[model samples]
Target: MACSGCYSVNFMAVSSNPNKPLTSSTLLTSKLSSSYSQIPFSSLNFNSKLSRIQLHKSNTAPNSFVVVSGIKAEPLKVMISGAPASGKGTQCELITKKYDLVHIAAGDLLRAEVAAGTENGRRAKECMEKGQLVPDEIVVTMVKERLSQPDSQEKGWLLDGYPRSSSQATALKGFGFEPHIFILLDVPEEILVERVVGRRLDPVTGKIYHLKYSPPETEEIAARLTQRFDDTEEKVKLRLLTHNKNVEAVLSMYEDVTVRVDGSLSKEDVYTKIDTVLRNVLGQRQAAIVLLVFPCDMFGISTA
Candidate 1:
C-alpha cells in the first residue's frame, strides 16, 4: 500500500499448532491493508500445537519489508555543514538524487518565507535589510515544524544550514535528534568569493550558473545572466565571516563526528569523497543503497 507517496508491503501468517506449526516453506499469498493498526490473515496449516508463526512474501511486491527473527530498525539521520558559496547546495542535489535523503536547506527556507510575505519572512526580511541576524527561535521553530511532518519518518534526511549555533545544537538534542554524520565543506575564502561573484541566476527557472566555472552556451544567453544582489564581494565576505564564527562555535560544542571535504575540487570529485564518507559513516555497502532506502522525491516539502 502507498503511504506518504511511497509503497510498502507487509504480511503475516498464523498457525494453531504449538510445535512444527509454521515453517519458512509455508507458502502464502494474501492482500492486506497498509495500515499498521489492521492485521490481515490468510488460511493457516499446522502440524502440531501452533508454536510459531512466520510471514513470507512473493517477489512481485514493489517494496518488500520482512521482519527478521530478531532485529530492530533504526532511523537514519545526517547533517550537512558548509560556509556560503562552498557548493553545499550542489553537492546536496547530487546526494538527494542518488539517495532518497530529504534535503533541508535553511537559506532556501528563509528565502521562501520572505517571498511568501509570511510574518516570519517579513521579520527576516526586515532583519536582512537592517544587516541584522534573524532571531534563532524563529528559525528553529520553522525547522522543528518541517521535521515533524509525516514524510520525514522512516526515510533518511540531509539537513543544511541548521544548528547555526551551539544553542541550537543543544536544542536539537533536547528534541531527540542527533546526526549520525556531520559534513563540513572546506573551501578557500578567495575561491569562494570568486565563485560567488561570478554566479548568475536565471530568473525564469532559478538555475544558477557561474561565468568562470559554468558559463552558458551562447553569448546572448550568457549576457542575460543576472547576478544576485547579495552575491557581491563585500556581501560574500561578510557572510563568510559570520558563517566561520558561528560554525566554529557550533562544531566545538558537538563531539568529533565531522568529515571535512575540500569544496574547491570539481563537483564530481567532491561527490566521490562525500559518497565515501557517507558509506563509512552509514556502514552501507554503497551510497546507492542508502539512497534507495531514503528516497525524497517530493517537491515543495518544507525543509525548514
Candidate 2:
C-alpha cells in the first residue's frame, strides 16, 4: 500500500544464541576480487583495492542497505527498541551528535504538544494523566508528520518510540519507511528499577540525571531535583511489564535484523559496540553493491 501523503524519493542485523562471530562467505571474497579486476589496475587503484579487501575481511560486516556505485547514499533510518528507561535516550543523544542524525523521541514530541496546547497534545495529555496509552493512530500520524519534515530528508533519523505495536510497524512499511537497523537494548529488570528510582529531572530544562551515575553535585540541590511521579517503583514496574509485552510482539516482526546490545555495560562500551555493528553493516552493503555491478567483468567471465 502506498502512503497517502506526499511521496518523496528519499533514499534510506542480528543474531543470538551465544552470539557467534559473523563470518562472510568465501564467495563474497571471490566476488570482491573480481570486482577489483574490472577496474584499471593502476598503483593508486591497486592500493585502494587492497585497502577495500582488507576492510571487508575485518570482523565487521554489513547488515543491509548495500551501497551501489553512482547511487546516492540515503539517510539511515534507525529504530531504537527497548523497554522504558533503558538508556535509549542517552544512546540517541550520542549517536545524533556523532553521525549528524535527527533524533525523534515520541514521548518528547507528545509532551511538547501538550506544552504547546495542540489538540493532539491535549488529548494525549488527558490519556497520560489517566495512565492510559495514547491511541496508535494519533501516534502514527505524529510520526508521519515528523518523518515528512525537511530536516528528516537531509539528516538520517533515529526513531526513539512510536511503534508500540505490530499494526504501527505494518503502517510504516506501507508508508515506505523501512529501518536499516533495529537495535534492542537488553538490561536486567533489577537494574532498570534502580535506575528509574534514582532518576531526577530538571523541570526547568527537562534534563535528566541519575543519583548514582549522574547526580547533581550536592544532596541539597539533588534533593530539590524532582522525581517524576510516574517514576515511582510501582509505576516503573507496571510500565516495564507493558513495555516488555509490547516489545516482544513488535520484535516478532523483525526477528532476522534485530541487534541486541548489552545495556548492562557502561554507556561508552554500549555505544562502541553499536557503532562497530553499524559500520560493519554499512560496509557489507557497499561490498555487495560493488560486486553486483561488475560481476562478469570482475571474474573474467564473458556474459556476452
Candidate 3:
C-alpha cells in the first residue's frame, strides 16, 4: 500500500495547546501528561488516544481549525455509508475541504466510465439496462483504478457509495485498501423518504439539490435539473431497506473503527460531529510519530 504520495510527520513530543505553536525546544522538552498518557504509535492503528484539539474562530463565523498530535503512515482513507438522502455528499465535501482528501464517489466513477463508453462501462450499462445490479468486480476494478491515480495516492481518499455487501468489503481489504475509518450516517426512515421527494440532480456537475431546502440558484441551473426515476417514496423505501441489509453486513466488518452519527441533525451539526471523529482518528499516535496540529489562522503556518 506504500506510494510515492505518502507523507509522514515525526515528532518527539506534543504541545497540548494547538494555539501555542510548538517550538524546537518544546519538542525536546515537553512532557506527556497523565491524561494524555504516552501510547505506543504504529502506522495503521487507531487505538492510540488523540492528544488534543484546540479550535479558534471569529465572532461572526467559525473559520478556525483543530490541531493535535497524530501520525499517518499511509494517506488518509475514509469510507461513508448512509441511506439515500442522508446528506452523504454534503458531508463528503466538508471532509474533503477539512482533510484535503480526494472525494471518490463510486457511482460518479461508474457513470463517467459509462459516459465514456469504456468496455467496463459497456458491460455495466448492459447489466443496468436489464435492471440488474452492476457486478461487484467491475465496480471494484474501476475503484482500484481511480485510487491508483497520483492524486488519490498522495492526498488520500473519501470513498462514497461502494462496498455495499460483506463480500465487497472483503475484496477491498483483500487489496489492502481497508479504510482507516468507516462512517455511518443514521437518519429516520420518514425523513429519508421525505428528502427523496424534492431531490434534483444536475447532470453536468453531478451536484444534488432539494427543491425546498436548497433549490437551484439560477433559472438555467433549475431548467437543467432532473430527478432520478427512482426518487419516488416507494423507491426510496425499497432502497433504504436494501441499504440497511447491506450495511448490517458491512458494519460487521468495520465494527472496531466504525463511527455512526445522526444524519437527521442540521448540516453544520452533522459535519461538526464527523469532523471531531476524523480529527480524533488522525490524532492517534503511531511509531512514536507525533503529528503536531497548529490552530490554523487561515493565514498562519501552512501544513500543506
Candidate 4:
C-alpha cells in the first residue's frame, strides 16, 4: 500500500541465500558480478568490468563525498543491526570516523525530539513511559525529516537502532530513503548478555568500559564509574529477546545487501571484517546518482 500524504513508496527485496537459486528478476537486480555485465552502461562508453576503487577524502570530512570519474557517488545509506551490547555503537563510531558519514541513532533522534517537547515526541513519550514500542509512522516521519538535513543528504548517513521490524523497514522505504547496505552483528546471546551486564559508563568522560574485559584504567577511575539503570541483567535479557524477535524478520528483507559479521571476535577483528565487507561493496561501485530528495523542504509532514 502507498503511504498517505505527499510521499510515494515502492519497495524491492533481494534474495542472497547462496544455496538457493535466485529467480529471474532477483538475479537481474542482484549486485553480483553476473548482473553488472548486464548493465547498459557499455553503450554509454562506460566500463562494465568491476574494478577496485579507493575512497578519497578532502581536508574536511563532510567535503570528502566520494567522486569517481566525474560522477559523484551515491550517498552511502547504511543500517547497522545488532543485539544489545553487540558493540554496534563502537563500530558505528569507528565507521563514522573512517568514512566521514553522518551517524543517526534512532533512539537518540527520538530522545532529542522528546527533550525538545515536539508533538510527535509527546506522543512517543506516552508510549515509551508505558514501556510500549513507538508507532512506526511517528518514527518513520522523524527519520525522514532527519535524512532531509543538508549534511545527511550530501555526505550520506549511517543509521543505527531503527527499523527493527519488517513494517518499520517498509515504512522507511516509503519515505524514499532505503538503506543501500545492511550490516548485521551476530554475537552469541551469552556473550551479548555478559557484555551488557558488565558494562560501565564513566560519569565524567562519558567513556564506556566493561567490568571484566575493559575495566577502568585504575581503581580511582573505577570508583568514579557508574552503570546505567538499564544495564542490569534482567533488562539486558529482555532487550535481547525483543531485539531477536524483530531483527530476524528485518534481516530477511535485506538478505542480498546484508553483511553478517561475527561479533564474538575482538573489537578490532570485528571491525576488520566489517571494513572488508564495506570495501568489497564499494569496489563493485554502481553509477552514481546524487539525489537531493528532500531539498527545499519539499517532503515531510504537514504541521497543520
Query: How high is the CA lDDT of each candidate model?
Result: 0.65, 0.66, 0.71, 0.67
Scored against the true structure, residue 271 in model 4 reaches a CA lDDT of 91
Q: Per-residue alpha-carbon lDDT of model 3 for 1-304, expressed as tens digits?
A: 1212212234322333322333333332212221121212221123233443333221222233333454336777999989878989889999998899999988678777788999998887775444345688899888888888999988899999777788888888888788889999999998998898899999889889899989998999999999875687776776777788788999999999899999999999999999998888777723446554333433242323
Cα-based RMSD of the predictions, in order? Answer: 13.9, 12.7, 13.4, 16.7
Task: Report the number of the highest-lDDT candidate.
Answer: 3
143: Cα error in model 1, Å: 1.2
Worst 10 residues of 1 by lDDT: 290-299
Q: Give the better candidate number (1 or 4) by TM-score.
A: 1
TM-score of each: 0.68, 0.70, 0.69, 0.65
lDDT of 2: 0.66
The pairs that clash in candidate 3 are 41-286, 41-287, 42-286, 42-287, 70-291
User: Candidate 1 on 1-304: residue-level lDDT in tens?
Assistant: 2323222223222322112233444433333223121111222232223233343321233233222121123445678888778998899999888777888887778878998999999988776544345688778777777766666655767888778878888887888777878888999999998998899987667788888888877776776788876788887787777777788888876558888889999999999999988778667422322101111122112211
lDDT, candidate 1, equals 0.65
How far residue 186's Cα lies from its native spot in candidate 2, in Å, is: 0.9
Native-to-model Cα distance after best TM-score fit, residue 149 in candidate 3, in Å: 1.8
- What ranking of all candidate models by lDDT puts the best one first? 3, 4, 2, 1
Off by over 4 Å in 2: 1-69, 129-131, 217-224, 291-304
For candidate 2, write residues 123-234 as lDDT tens digits.
8877665555677777888888898798986787889965777888888888877788899999999999999888998876688999889988666666668987667788
lDDT of 3: 0.71
Best by TM-score: 2
Better of 2 and 4 by TM-score: 2
Ranked candidates (TM-score, high to low): 2, 3, 1, 4
